[model samples]
Structure formats: C-alpha cells, structure tokens
Target: MRLAALPRRPSEPTITLINVVFLMLIFFLVAGQVAAPVDRDIQLIDAAALATRAPDDALAVRSDGTTLWRGEVTTPEAFAAARIADGAEVLRLVPARDLPAQDLLRIANALRMAGAAEVRLVTDRSAP
Candidate 1:
C-alpha cells in the first residue's frame, strides 16, 4: 500500500506584503522633509490635529484677522489675488491662537472667491 501524502506548510503571502509596506514606510520617513511652524512670529492656534502638514508657503494671520504674506501685512483679498495669480490651487492658512472664528471664516471665503479649490487651516500641535 502507498503511504499517505505528507501535509504541506501553509503559504505566507501576508509576510511579503508586510515586508513591502515596511520598506515603503521607511523610505518615506527618510525621504520626506520634517515640518516646522509656518512662522516664528505668528503664534499658531492649537487644537485637535490632522494628518497633513501645511507647506512653508502658507499665509499667516494675526489675532486681529490681519493677514501676513512674506512677512508683510496684507488684506485677505490681496493675498488671495496674488496667490491665485501665481497658479496656486490650494491655499494653506495659519491663524493665530487668539484670532476670532469669524475672521478666519471671512479670510477662507475670500480665498475661495479667488479660485482656491481648497483652503486648509493649519494649527499648532502642542501636547496637552
């Protein structure tokens, strides 16, 4: 009589996938730039955070709803106009810790009027 066939080991397809994922993660960590606050002079608001970090080209606003571009005070309309003229589709705004909610919304609306597809708010990531 012939002997019964031996049992085979289970395949580990997930292991290869896991390895590739880890390699990609490590590659991104090494290649990506670390983020710093948009401006040292403009104290950013602190709140629940998001995954995406704003780029260095963000527009900063002070507590009084005064917008600053390239370290110069500017009206929201002016800032939006210049940025839109430069072919920017997405606008990143860093509002001060004491900036009023109404001001923020107004500035965002102005940016939208200037053809910004998206206006992302950037906040400070402070430990509680």
Candidate 2:
C-alpha cells in the first residue's frame, strides 16, 4: 500500500523583543527618582504652647551641637556673612529638642553678635 504524503507544518516563529523593551522602559519610568523637600537632621524643641510662623531668616541647631543655616551646615561667622548678604534683619533660632542649654546660649550670643536686630525662638505646639 502507498502511504499518503503529509502536509508540512509552519516553522517556529522568532522571539519578539519589542514587548521586553517596552516593559523595561515602563519599569524605569516607575522607579525614577522623586524630588522631595530637603530637611536637615536638626531637631527643634517645641516648648512653646502653640505653633508660630517663622520668618525667612531661621537658624536651626541640631542635638549634636551642629548649627544649620537654612538646612546647610555653617559656622557662626559664615552664617553671619550669609545672613548679611541675604539682607536678613532678624534671626529666628530653633534649637533641637535634646539640645544642650549651653549650646543654645552660645548660638543666641553668636546670632546677636552677627548683626541680627532681634532673635526669636521657635517651638512646636503640643498635641491635644
């Protein structure tokens, strides 16, 4: 008996790389960096009974005895020069919660000598 000829099937298709490239692009877009406000490590003591708005010229002192001028580390002299250049008439001091009393005094004195017309202390309000 003669065997019938069988029909040939189609060859295997090549892999498509377009989907993989698209997925990689989407992954990178979702994992991209997001811009956030820059906050220094300085902690402020909230001794005041209520919260008050601070002026543009604010000096923050960290618990580790480090001084920050607008979220930037700076010495008293440098801070003074910057303040003068920025035309700051008054300086608001925000001391960290665990800041040493002596350090606060030194900062206050330094701010006073830096040509600040007045110095105001800032504190956060306690939760009810």
- Each model's lDDT: 0.82, 0.75
Cα error, candidate 1, residue 39 (Å): 32
TM-score of each: 0.54, 0.51
Q: Which 10-residue window in model 1 sums to the lowest lDDT?
A: 47-56
Name the regions of candidate 2 deviating beyond 4 angstroms.
Answer: 1-56
lDDT of 1 at 98: 86
Error of 1 at 126 (Å): 1.7
What lDDT tens digits, residue by residue, belong to model 1 across residues 35-124? 553776886666455454435578898898878888888877787778888888888899988888998898999889877889988886
Give candidates' CA RMSD values in order: 11.4, 16.5
Predicted structure with the largest TM-score when compared to the true one: 1
Residue pairs clashing, model 2: 43-96, 46-124
At residue 22, candidate 2 shows an lDDT of: 81
